[model samples]
Target: MFKGKNRFQSILLFILDLSILISSFYLASFISFGDFNPNYYYYSLLLGWGIIWVGVVLKYNLYEVPRILYVDKVLSKNFSAITVFIVLSAAAIYFFTSYKFSRIFFITVVSLFSFLLLIFRILFLYLVKSQRLKKDFRKRGVIIVGMNQNIQRLISRVYSRPQYAFFIEGIFTDTKLKGRLKNNHKGGLDDVKDYLLTNNPKEVVISLPHSYGDYIDELIHIADNNLVRVRVVPEFSEYLSQRFSIKYVENVPVMKFRKEPMQSLSNRILKRSFDIVFSLMAVVFIFSWLFPIIALIIKLTSKGPVFFSQERTGQDNVSFMCLKFRSMVVNTDSDNLQATKNDSRVTPFGSFMRKTSIDELPQIINVLFNQMSLVGPRPHMLKHTEEYRVLVNKFMVRHFAKPGVTGWAQILGFRGETKTVKDMEKRANADIWYIENWSFMLDLKIIFRTVFGMLFKRDKNAY
Candidate 1:
C-alpha cells in the first residue's frame, strides 16, 4: 500500500507549490498595479522566478521526505530553500535586469508564496499524522536483523516517531540483548529465511560488525531472494568517538571521524564576513563609547594597565595574546592562579565587570584581528592548557577551531573557574562537540544564549 508513496507525495507537493507561486504573482500584481494582467516584462520575470524556484526545490531536496519526519526538519529545509531562492531572486533583479520591476509586487509575491508553502507543509504533516493516529496510514513493513546498541537506537527511533510510517515487523538476531530491546526480538538469525518465506517484509536492515561479513552477506542474499529491500548499517561506534561520514578516496572507503563545517571555504568566508561586519558594528556602536569609560574606571580602580593580555591557545594549537579588560589587580599569581569567588585579586569595579561580562568586551578587537571567532570554544590561558592537556582527555581538541569570545561551554554554565579535573573534562567535551557539529545557525544560537544568559541569568561560576 505504501509503495511509491514518497514519489507520489513529492509530485503533489511540487504541483501545490507551483500553484501557490502562480496565484501569488497574479494576486500581487493585482494589488500592486491594480490589474491581474501584467506587462511582458513581468511575464519574463515570472518565468525566471519559476525556474529559480524549481532549481532551489531540487537543490534542497524538498521532494524527498524522510521516513522519520519531524516538523522542525520540514520547516528548516523549507526555510533554507526559500531563503536561498529569495537571495537568488534579489541577485537576479540587481545584476540581470535593466528593466524596473515593481518592488512592492515582487516583495508581496515572495512573501505570499513563502507563507503559503509553509502553511501547505504544516497541513500536509498534520494530515499524515492524523492518518497515522487513525491507523489509516499504511507503513512499510521493516524487519531488523541485528541486536546491538546501534540497532537498539534504531528501534527506539522508529518507535519514538510514529509519524515516520515505518512499522517493525520483527527483529532477527543471534546475540541476546538485555533490557527494553529484548521484547522486540523474534527468532534467531537462522530462522530469518523461514520468517521471510512466511511473513515477507518490505525491507531488511542488517547492522552487524565487520566480523560478521560472511553471515551478513548471506542474510542480504536471502532478503534479495525474498524480494525485500536491504540496508546495511556499518558498526563503527567502537572505533569512532564522534560523528563520522563515509567517503570514497578513489576506490577505497575512508571514514572521517569528524566533519567540520568550517573546513569548507564558503563557510569560512561567510563566518569571516559576518565576524568583520559584527565586530565593526560592536566597535562603532558599543565599544566606541563604552571602551573609554571602562578603561578610565579600571585605571582608577586598579593599579595595572586597563587592558590585560595573556598568551592563550588559538586554532591549530597556536598561541596568541588574548585581550580582555583588566578585572584584577597586578599580582605575581595572576597568570598561574584562577580567580576564586570573592578572591582578593578582583577589584571593586572589576567584580561588577566580571559579573556582567563587561570585561570580555575587549576581545572584540581580537575578533577584528581574526585571532578569534565571535562564537567557538573559549581560549584558555597557557597554564590551564598545559595542565588540562595531561589531565583531561581530548582537551586539546578544542583548539581545532578558533577561540571564541563566548562559547557553547560558557553558555552551558561551564564558564568561570574549573576547580576540579571533571569540570574541565565537561568543558572540553562541549568544545569538542561544538567543533564536530559546527554550523552557522549553531554559532548564532550560542551568541544568543550568551547574551540572554548575561542579561537574565546569574552565573555563579562567573566569579
Candidate 2:
C-alpha cells in the first residue's frame, strides 16, 4: 500500500534538485567566463557530480520536506552533498583526464550552487507551508496508541506546528482515562487491532509507559503486520538528555546521551571561526564609528560609565562580565534588581537604546574573545539563573554552549523580566531547543531575525 503522496513528492524533488544542480554550474561558468564550452571529460565530471550529489541528498534525508523545514538542516545537507560531489568529481577527473581545472572556476561553481540550493529550499518551504493550510491539502494520518501525558504533549506539539501537516486520526488509549470522553477514542488496547484495521493510518505512535510494557510487542505486531510504521516514545525520554548518539559495542547497540552539537570539535571550530569573522566585521564596520557617538550621548544623558558590565553565567555555569552600552543612570541596586517595564532608573536615551537593543552592540567584543557565541542561549543574570534553576527543569542545560548576545528565546519574545514561572519556563525551553539543535545556518537565521526585529519595532518588554 502507498503511504500517502510523500513518495511522489520525493520523486519530483529529486528531478528538480538534479536540474538545479546542473543549472547552477552552467550559470556559474557563464558568469565566470563569457560562454559555456565543455570537453567530453568535463561532461563526464558533471555526470559524476550529479550522481554523488543525489546519493548524498538521499543519505541526508533531504527529500523529506515536511519535517525539516528548518533552513539549518537544508544548508547542512546541501553542504554535505556538495562536499561529496566535489570529492567524487575530483577523483573521477584525476583518474581519467589530464585536463587541469581552474581554481577560480571550481570555487565559483561551488559557491553558486550553494547559494542557489539554499534559495530553492527556502522557496520550497514557503510553498509547502502555504499548501498545507489549504482545506484539501493532503496530510499524513497518524494514530496515537496510548494514554499518558505524552499523548497530550504530542497533540499540543502537532497543533503548535502545522507545517508538519500530520492529522491525528484518533487517539486510541488502553485505559479508561479522562481522554476517553472524546469521540475519537475508538477503543482501548483490545480495540487497537480493530482501530488499525479500520483507520488505515500511515503511522502509529506508541506512548505507553514502561509499566504497560506488555502491550508494546502486540501493538508493534499489529502496526507492522498492516504496513503501518511504528514509533515508540520511550518513557525514559523525559529523564534523559535531549539528543542521543548510537554506537556499536562490537555488534551490540549502545545509546549515549548528549545535549548539543557544539560538543564536537569540528562544530566548535566552525562556530568559533564564524564568530571571529562576524565580530571583526561588526567591530570594524559598525562599532568603530558608531560607538563614539553613542558613548558621548550616554555620558551627557547619564552619570555612569559608558559601558555597563555585569557578571552573568555562561557555558558550564562559569561567570563572565557581560558587556553592554550603559543605558541607565548610576544605581547601587543594579546588581540585585530586575529592570521592570518603564523603570525609573532608565534614562531617556537609555530607554531608546534598550527598546532598539543598541545597548547590546558592545557584546560583539565578548563574541570576539570567545566568551559569547553569535547564537546560543542568552545568558541570564546570576540571580535569575539561581532562582530559575530551581523553578525550571534542565535550566542548566542552556549553559551547554557559550552564551549568545541574541538567541532563539529573545527572537521568540521570551526576553525581559519573567512575570511568571511559566514565562521563565518558556524561555528556558526555547534556549534548550537552541542548544539541542545548534547549527551555523540556524545561528545565521537567528541573527537575521534579531537584526530585522530590532530595526522594525520596539521590543515590547525591553525596559
Candidate 3:
C-alpha cells in the first residue's frame, strides 16, 4: 500500500541534475572549441562540478526531505549553487593549473546548466503536485506519533496538499479525542512498537511535547527495529516559525528560537552593503538639504534642539542613542511617556513631521553608523523596552537583530502609543515574526510598504 522508499525521488533528481550538467558542459565545449574533450582534465572538472553541486545543495538543504519539496526555494538555491560552482571553478583552474579555460565556454555552460537545472526542478514539482492529485499515483506512507500542535500542523499539511506524495497511514497518540479515525489512535507510548511492526510506514513523524522525552528512546527503538525513518518535531516547536533553522554545535543539533537571517555571514554582508549604499545615497541627496530646513523650522517653531537623542534598545540588548526630529516640547516625561493623539506638547510642525514619519529620517544616520537596520523591528524607548519585556515574554527577542527606523511592527500598524498591554503584545509578536522571517526580499517589501503608507495613509496614533 506504501511506496517502497522516498529516497528514490532524491536519487532520481540527483541523477537528472548530473546528466543535465554533463550535457551542458559538453555542449559548451563543442560549441566553443568545435570539438569535445574527453581528457583527464575534462573528467576532473566534471568531478569538481559534482562535488560543488552536492556540497552547495547539502549546505543549503536543497534535498533534505523527499516528499516535502519546495520548488521555488529550490530554484533560488540552484542559482546560488551554480554561482558558487562557477566562482570556485574559476579559482581552482586559475591557481592549480596553467590550462587556459575559455571564458565563453564557461559562461555558456554556467548559464545553460542553471537554466536546465531550474527547469528540471520546476517540472518535477509540477509533476508531483499534479500526479498526487490523481488517486492512482504511488504515495509515500507516513504516520504521526504523539498529540500536540505539531501533530495538528502535520495532519493539516499532509491532508491539504494531496498533490504531494504523502499518505498519512494513521495517527498514534495517548490523548483521547472524539471522532478520530478508527484504529488510528494507538493505545499509548508503549504501543508504538507493536504499531510499527503491524503498520510499517515509510516515515514516522514524532510530534510530542517536551514531557514525552522518555518515550523518544522507545519510539526510536521501534523505528530502528522496523527500519522506519523518524522525524522529530522539537518540543514547543510553536515558539519558532516555519523558517526556523538548526545549527550543529559539537554534533548536537540546536534549534534557533528566532530565525535571524543576518546570522548567516553572506546575509550579514549583503545587508550591510545595502545599508551603506542606501544610507550614503540618502545622506547625500535627501539629508544634505532637508536637515538644514528642518533645523531652521525646529529652531524657529520650538524652544528645543532640532534633534532629540534618547536611550533606545538596539541589537543584543544594547542601548544606543536614538535620534529623531523633536516632536514635542522638552519635558521630564519625554523618556517614559507614551505619546498620544493630539498631545499638547506636540508643536504644529512637529505634529506634521510625526504624521509623515519624517521625524524618523534622522535614523538614516543610525543605519549609516551600523547601529540600526533600514528595516527590522523598530527600536523602542528604553523605558518601553524594560516595561514591555516584563509584560510580553518575547519582547526582548526583537533585539536579536538591529532595530530599524521603520519596521515590521510599524508597517503592520502596531507602532506608536500602546494604550493597552495587548497592543504592546501584538507589536512584540509582529517584531518577533519579522526577526524570524527576515529576508532581503521581505525587507524590501516592508520598506516599500512603509514608504507607501507614509505617503498615503494617516496614522491616527501619531501625535
Candidate 4:
C-alpha cells in the first residue's frame, strides 16, 4: 500500500510512531499500577514524552534513511534516543519535586514504546519488500554519464539493493577499453546528450576523476536544461576529509571543508536550549543545595572568597568572567599560575575539587547566560590567548564559536598546563578542528571521552 507519494509515506510513518507511543504509555500504566487513572500529571508527562521522542527522531535522521529500512539500524537509533530521553526525564523528576508519578511506570512506558516502534518499522520494511517483489512497481531508471571507479562502486551498491527500486541504464565511459563488462558500457562522452534525450532517465550520476576538473562545467551545462536530478561523485579520496557540507554565500555555492562534522542549525539551537534549561535547573536545584557546604569548606581551608572569577575569551572574541570555586592559595597571582602536580598553592579541599572537576561546576551559570556552550573549544585566558595566537596557526579561528567548560581538547588529554610552546600549539590545533567540525554527535562523543578520561586518569596534563 506504501507507493507513489513520498510525503504520504512520511506522514504515515509519523502517525505510526505516535500510535506506538500512546499505546505503550497505556500498557505501562497498566503494568505498573494495574489500573488506569489519567490525571493532569499524566497528561503533562505524555506531552513532554512526545516532544522528546519527535525531537530525537528529527535530530537523528531516523525517518530519512532512504527506502530500505534495516531493523538493526532502526532499533539502534531508537535505543540511543530513548536513553537520552530517559536521562532527561529523570532529571526533570528530580528537579520538579511535585510530580509523584511512578518511576516504574515511566521506565516501562519508554521501554515498551521503543520496542513497539522497532517492531513496527521492521514489519513495515518486510511488507514493503514483499510487495515490491510480487508487484510490478515503477522503478526509477538511473544513468551514469561517466565510467570510473566511483561509478562502478555506485552501480555495484545499487545492484545489490533490489528493494530500493532503482534501475541502472548502463554506465557511459569516456574511453573505449578491452574486457568491458557485457551490456555495461553504452558509448563515449560525445553520445551522452543523445542517450539522455532518447532514454529520459529519472536521474543522472556523473562520476568523473579529479583530473577531469575542467570538463565539469560543460557536463553541468548539458544536464542543466533537463528535468532529471543530477548528482556528482567527486574524487574525495585525494582529500582524505571526513566532513562535507554545502552552503551558499551571496548566491554562490561553496563547500565547507573540515576534519569534523558540522552540526545542523536546528541541532545547535536544541543543544543551546538544553544547555540553558539544564544550567538553570542546576543553579536552582543542585548548586543552591551545595553552595553553602562548598563555601564553608573554602572559608575554613583558606582566606579567599568562595568563588574565583577569571577573564576568558569566549565565542566571537567576546570576553566573559568565568566562575569557579576557589581552589588555590589566597594570595597567589591567578594570572601567572598554572596548576601543576604537587603544586603547593592548592589547599587540601581545593586539590580534591580540582581533581574531581567540581571547582569548574560554577561555569554552568556561564553556559546558561550564553557566554559559553556545553561543549566546544575550551576558553583560554586573555594573556594565554595572546601568547598562543602567535605560536599556533589558526589559533584565533577557534574563537568562531563559544568556548565551553569542557571541550574536545580537554577530553583528548590536552587539558591543563601547557609547559611548552609545542604543547599549546597542539591543543590549539585540536580546538580549531573541533570548531570546524561541530555536531551534536561529536559533543556526545566528547562528553563520553571526558567521563572515561576522568575515571582512568588518562589526561596527564589535567593537573
lDDT against the true structure, per candidate, is 0.84, 0.80, 0.79, 0.74
TM-score of 3: 0.68
Residue 222 accuracy (lDDT) in model 4: 62
The candidate maximizing TM-score is: 1
Query: Can you write out model 1's per-residue Cα lDDT over 414-440, one digit (the tens) per residue?
Result: 989998999999999999988876766
Candidate 3, residue 424: lDDT: 88
Which residue pairs show backbone clashes in model 3?
Answer: none
Model 2 CA lDDT for position 261: 76
Q: Which ten residues in a row have the lowest lDDT in candidate 4?
A: 258-267
Candidate 4 clashing pairs, residues 3+ apart or interchain: none
Each prediction's number of clashing residue pairs: 0, 0, 0, 0
- lDDT tens per residue, model 4, 1-463: 2245666877788889889888888888778878665555787888877887677767766665455545444555555576667777677677875868888888898889867876787788677777656548767777777665656656666643577777777667766544544466778777777876666677788877777776666666666767677888776743543456678999998887653333456446657876887678878998898988999999998987999999998877888999899898876468766788888888899887887677888888889888988788888889888888888777887888788878988876787888888888888878877776565556767777766765666344554
What C-alpha lDDT, on a 0 to 100 scale, does residue 1 get in candidate 4? Answer: 24
User: Tens digits of per-residue lDDT for model 2 on 204-284?
Assistant: 888877887878888888788899999887776766646676789998989887656778786787779778988999888
All candidates in order of TM-score, best leading = 1, 2, 3, 4
lDDT, residue 343, candidate 3: 84
Instruction: Pull out the clashing pairs in model 2.
Output: none
The number of the candidate with the highest lDDT is: 1
- Expressed as tens digits, the lDDT of each residue in 1-463 for candidate 3 is 1134656777777788889999998988888878786345666777877887787766766654446765544554555566667778788778876776678877888888888987877787777777778988888787777777666777767644776667667777778755544456656666777788887678888877777787787788878888899989877666654456689999998866555667898677767877899889989998999999999999999898889998989999999999999988998889878788778889999999999999999999899899998988888888888888898877788889898888888887888889999998898889888876666656767889988988999887776
Whichever of 1 and 2 has more TM-score, that candidate is: 1
lDDT of 1 at 284: 95
TM-score of each: 0.83, 0.78, 0.68, 0.60
